[model samples]
Target: MRLADLTTIGVGGEPELIVDAYTREQLVSALNDAWDGDWFVLGGGSNLLASDEPFAGTVIRILTSGFARIDGAPEGFQRVSIEAGQNWDEFVAWTVAQGLQGVEAMSGIPGTAGAAPIQNVGAYGQEIVQTLVSVDLIDEGSSEIVTVPASELGLGPRTSELKRHYGEEPARVAVIAGITLDLRVVGTDPAPVADERIRAALSLASDDAVTLAQIRERVLAIRASKGMVLDPTDADTRSAGSFFNNPIIAEADARLLPESCPRWPVEEVAETVQVFDLATWDGQVPRVEAPASRVKVSAAWLIENSGLPKGFSLPGSRAALSTKHTLAITNRGGASSDEIAELARYVRMRVSGEYGITLNPEPVFVGVEL
Candidate 1:
C-alpha cells in the first residue's frame, strides 16, 4: 500500500504490505510478528513524514476502537480508558459533551489519544501529563501487555521516554494498547479558569468563568487559524502539524536571541510556586536539577527572522511553509517527500546559520533524512 494515501502529508512511497488490526488480540499479534521481521506500525498517520522511496517492510495500521469510564479511579475526576486507535478529536469532542474539563484546551489536535503521551501533547497550557493516570502498553522485547503509571513516562514539554526523535532512539520501545486519563469532573457547569497560557490562547479575561464546551470551541478556532486543525481542502493543513519543535536551549544561548522572540523557561513559575506554610517550614532547600532549567525559544520566530517567511518555498518546489504558521512545512498540492525534506533542510540551515542554534523537527521520519 502507498503511504501517500495513508499519511496526512500524502507524500510517501509504498510499503511491502498493509495490515489493519481492528481488535486487541489482532493488534498484539501484529506487533509481535513485526518485532521478528522488518515492520512499521502506523496510527493516525498525522505525525509522520516518510520518504518517497518504498518503506521496505510490512506496515501495520492500528484501527482498533473502544473507550470506557472505569470505576474506582479517583474522587472528583472521571477515569476513562481509551483504545490506542480511537480518533483523538472524536474523543475530545465526547469529553466536552460529557462536561469533562482537563483536555478541553487540547480540543483540535490531530492524531489518536494513544499518541498523546508519546510526545506529551499539549496546547494552551494543558498537557496529557496532567491527567494521564496510566497506559496499557505492549513491551516490544517481551511481547507482554502491562499497565504503566504516567509518572514513569517522564513526560516534558514535547518529549517522553517513548518518543523517537530523529537520530535518537526512544528510551523504551513499546506500543501503547490503551490510555487512561483522569479528567476533572465539571459535570455540566461553568468552571473558573485560571491557567494563564489558556487564558492567553483564548483571549479571556482573568476572571472569566467558562464551560468545557466553550473552551473547546475557542481552542478549535485557534488551531484552525494556524492550520493546526485538519481540513482536507486546506493545503496548509496537508503536513505533519509542526515541522520543528521549539528549541530548548541553555539560558545563555537564549540571551543571544533577539529580545522580540518569545521564550519560556523549562522550570516555569507555575510549577515553582510556594504553597507551604512558612511558619512551619524548615530551613533546608530541596534538591533540584539546576541544569534542567532551560529556555525554549520559538522556532517560528527564528524561521521568519532568518528570512524564511510564511508560505516560503524554494523555486519550482511544491513544499511550502504554512501560510498561517511558520512552524509547519506544508505540501502545496502534489509535493513530493523529497520536496518536503528539502524545505525542512533549507529552513534548518537558514535558522541555524542566522542564530547558531539548531532547530529539531517534531515528526517521526521513515526512510527520509534532513
Candidate 2:
C-alpha cells in the first residue's frame, strides 16, 4: 500500500515492504527481524513527510491497541497503561468520559499514544510530560523489553531523547511498546481551569466554572476550526498539524521582532544537584549564576507578517498554506512530495529574511528535505 493511503497528509510513496504489527509481541518480533536493515516505525502517520520516490526499506506500522488500569497510582490518581499503537484521540475521549483531568485540554490531537512522548505532545497548555509516568521499550541492540521512567526521556518542546532530528541521530534509539500515565479522577466535575492559554481560548474568566467535558468539547471545536482535527472532507486538514515549531530563541533575538508579534517567555527550570560531597570540596566557595531566559515567538505570526497569508501557494503547485491556519502547509489534493518541500522551503526563507529567525519544521522527514 502507498504511504499516502495511511498518512493524514496523504502524499508519500510506497515502501519496499509494509508490515503491520497489531500486538506487542508482533511489534517486538518485527523490530528484531528488521534490526539489521533499514526500517521506519509508523504510528498514526500524522507527523511525517515521505518522499515521492519509493522507499528502499521496510516500514513497520504499529497497530497495537489496548489500555488497562494498573497498580502503583499516586494518591488521588490512577495509573493507566496504554499500548503504543492506541489512537490518541480515542484515549482522550475515554479519559474525558471517565472524568480524568490532565489530558482534557489535548482532546483532538492526531497520531498514536506512543508518539506522544517522542515530541512531548502538548496542546491548550497540556503536555504529555505532565502525566507520563514511564514507558516500556526495547533499547537498540537489546532483545528484551525494559521500562524507563519519564525523566530519562529528556522530554522537551516537541522533542525527546528518542526523536531523530533533521540530519542527526537520536540520543537513544529505541521503540516504545507502551506507556503509563498517572491521571487525576476528577470525573465530570466543574473546576476552574488553571492554564491561562486554555482560559483565553475558551474565553473563560479565572473563576469561571468548567467541567472536563466542557474543556474537551471546546478544545475539539477549536482544533476543527483551524483544520487541525483530521476529516477526509476537509482538504485543509490534509497536512501535518503544524509545519514549523514556534521558534524558541534567546530573549535578545526575540526583542528584534515587531512589537505586535506574539511571544512567551520559556520557564527556566532549576538545575538539580545530585550530590555535594563536602569531603572532596575545594577550600574556595563556588559562584552561582543563572543563564539568560529564552523566548518562544509565534511561527504563524511570522509567516503571516512575512507576506504569506492563509491559503497562499505557488503559481501552479497543489501545495498551499491551510486556509484556516498559517502554520500548516496543506496538500491541496494530488500534490507531490516535492511540492510540499518547495512550499516549506519558501516559507522558511521568507520568514528568515523578514525576521532573521529561522523556523524549524516539526515533522519527521523521510527522503524529503527543505
Candidate 3:
C-alpha cells in the first residue's frame, strides 16, 4: 500500500500489507492477529507523518462501521456509539442534523471517529473529551475488547492512554475500534444559541444572532480559508491538520512575556496547561499552552521569528511551509517524506535555538522520527 495514497500529505512511501476491516468483529480479529504477529495499525492517516521508505510490516486500515444510539434518557441526553471507520466530518454533520449540539464546532476536522479519543481531537474551543463517554478498544496486549471510560483513558490535550503505550517502550502502538459520545439533544433554537457562543469565540460572527446551521457553515468556511478543511484542489489541505500542538508552558515562563499575551483559564487551555501568546520579532502572534500547569506557546510564532518565513524553503526545495498557514508543512507535488522531515527538523531546531524551548510534533510518525 502506498503511504501517499493513505495520507492527506500525499508524500509517504509504501507499506508491505494493507488490511481493511469493515466490521467490528473483523476489526477485532485483525487487531488480535496483528498484535500476535506484530503489525502496525493505521486509521484515517490524518495525523500521521510517514517516511518515504517502504514499511515492511502489516498495515491494518480500520474500516469498522457502526452508528447507533445505544442509550438516551427521555429528557434527551443520549449516548451515541460510532465505529472508528466513519468519517468524522460526516458524523458531526449527522449529529447536527439530529439536533445534537456538542460536536458542531468540530465539523470539518479530518479523520475517523475512532481517532478522536486517540488524541482527544479538538478544535474551535471544543474537544472530544467534553463529549466522549467511553472508548471501545482492542487491547493489543490482552487481545480482549474493553470499554474504557473517558477518565480511565487519561485524556489530555492531544494525548491519551491509547496514544501513550504502556510496558516496554512508552510510545508503542495500540488500536482503537470505536468510541461512544454523550450528546445532548437540544431544541433547534438551542442549537443556534450554542452556535452563537462558538461563533463569538471564533470571531467569525459579525453579530451574535447566527443560526446553528449558519454557524456551522461559517466555521467550515473559516476552516477552509485556513486550509483546515479537506480540499482536493488545494495542496495546502494536504496535511495532517496542524503540525504542532500549541506549546503549553509554566506560568512563570509566561510572565516573561509582555502584558499583551492572551491568557485563559487553565481548563480552557489544553491539558490543564496555562497558555500564553507570544509576539514574534516580526510582529506575528502565536499562542502556546503548557500541559503541566504552565503556559502554552505558539510554535508558528517561534518559527517565523527564528528567521523562517511562512513559505520558508532551502534552495531548490519542493517542500515548504503552507503559504495559507505557517503552522503547516506541505508537499508541493513530488516532494518526498524525507524532505518534509528535514524541513520539520529545521523548523524545530531553529525555534529551540532561538527561544530555549523544544517544539513537539503533533502528528504520529510512521517509519520515521524527528
Candidate 4:
C-alpha cells in the first residue's frame, strides 16, 4: 500500500506489504507473525511521517474492534475498556454520551484508542495519562500479553516506555491491544451546599446536568476551529495535530521573552511559553524541536512574523501553508513529500531569520530524514 493512502499528510511512498487485522485474535496472530518475520505496528497513521521511498518491511495495520466496561460503580463511576483499533474521537464521543468527564477535552483527536496511551495523548489542558488506568500489551521478548499500569508505561510528554526502548532495542516492536480508563459519573443533582464550591470548580454546575455527550460536542467544536479535527475537504486538517510539543523552560529563561508571552509553571523550577524559530535545521529543513530549557513558543506566530503568512508559497507551487492555520503544511494537490519538506524548510528558515528561534516538526519521519 502507498504510504500516501494511509497517512493524513497524503505524502510518502509505498510499503512492501500491508496487512489489516480486524479482530483481536487476528491482531494477536498478525503481531506474532510480525515478530517471527519482523514488522512494524501501524495504528491510525496520524503521528507518523514516513519516507518517500518504498518501505521494505511488512506494515501490520491494526483493525481490531471492541469496547466494554470492566469495572467501577455502575451508578457514579466506571472503568471502560476499548480495543486498539477503534477511532479515538468516536470512543471519546461514546464515553461522553455516557456522562464520562475524564476525556472531554480530548475529543476530535485523530488515530485510534491504542495509540492514545502510546504518547499519553493530550489537548486543551488534559492528557490521557490523567485518566488512563492500564494497557494490554504484547511483550515482544517474552511473547506474553501483559497488562501494565499507566505508571509502569512511563508516559511523559508524547513519550512512553514503548517509545523509549527501556528494556529492549530502539526498534523493538510491540503491539498494543487495548486500554482501560477510569471515568467518573456525575449524578443529576448538585452536591450538598457544603460541597457546592468544589463541585463547581470541577465544572459540575448546580442546576445543569452535564453529560459526556455535551462535553464531547463542545470539545469537538474547539478542536475544529483549531484545524485539529479530521476533514478531508479541508487541507488544514491534512497533517498531524500540533507540529511541536510546547517546550518547558526554566523560569529565568522564560522571563527573557516579551511580557505578552504567556507563562505557566510546569514545575517549581520550570515555566513554559511557546516560541517559534524559522531557521531550524540550519535552513535545510523546516522543523521545530522543543528544547527542555526554553518555554515552547508558537510555530505559527514565528511563521507569520517571519514573512511566511498563512497560505504562503513559492510561485506555481502545489504545497502551501493552510489558510486556516499557520502550523500546517498542506498539499494543494499532488504535492510530493519533498515539496512539503521544502515548504516546511522555507518557513523554518524565515522564522529563524526573524526570531532567532527554530521550529521543529512533530511528525515521525521514516525512509527519509529532514
- The prediction achieving the highest TM-score against the true structure is 2
TM, every model: 0.93, 0.94, 0.86, 0.80
- lDDT tens readout by residue for model 3, 1-370: 6889998888777777778888878777776666656467667788888888888777888887668888653366878899889898888888877777678888799889998988888777788998988887776665677878788888887788667321123242456788888888774553234444465566754444544566578779988888888888888888777887667778777676555545443454444444445552655445654445566666677677788887777777778888787789888888888888888888888978876777778887776667
In model 1, what lDDT does residue 208 have? 90
Model 1 bad stretches (over 4 Å): 268-292
TM-score of 1: 0.93
Each prediction's RMSD to truth: 4.1, 3.0, 9.2, 10.8
Q: Per-residue alpha-carbon lDDT of model 4 for 265-355, expressed as tens digits? A: 5533334454557655344543555444435455676676667777787777788887777777777787787777777678767866875
Looking at candidate 3, the ten consecutive residues that score lowest on lDDT are 164-173
As a whole number from 0 to 100, the lDDT of residue 292 in candidate 4 is 49
Instruction: Estimate the TM-score for candidate 4.
Output: 0.80
Q: By descending TM-score, how would the candidates be arranged?
A: 2, 1, 3, 4
Candidate 2, after superposition: displacement of residue 320 in Å? Answer: 0.4
Error of 1 at 20 (Å): 0.6
lDDT of each: 0.89, 0.91, 0.75, 0.71
lDDT by residue (326-345, candidate 1, tens digit) is: 99999999999999999999
Alpha carbon lDDT at 238, candidate 4: 83
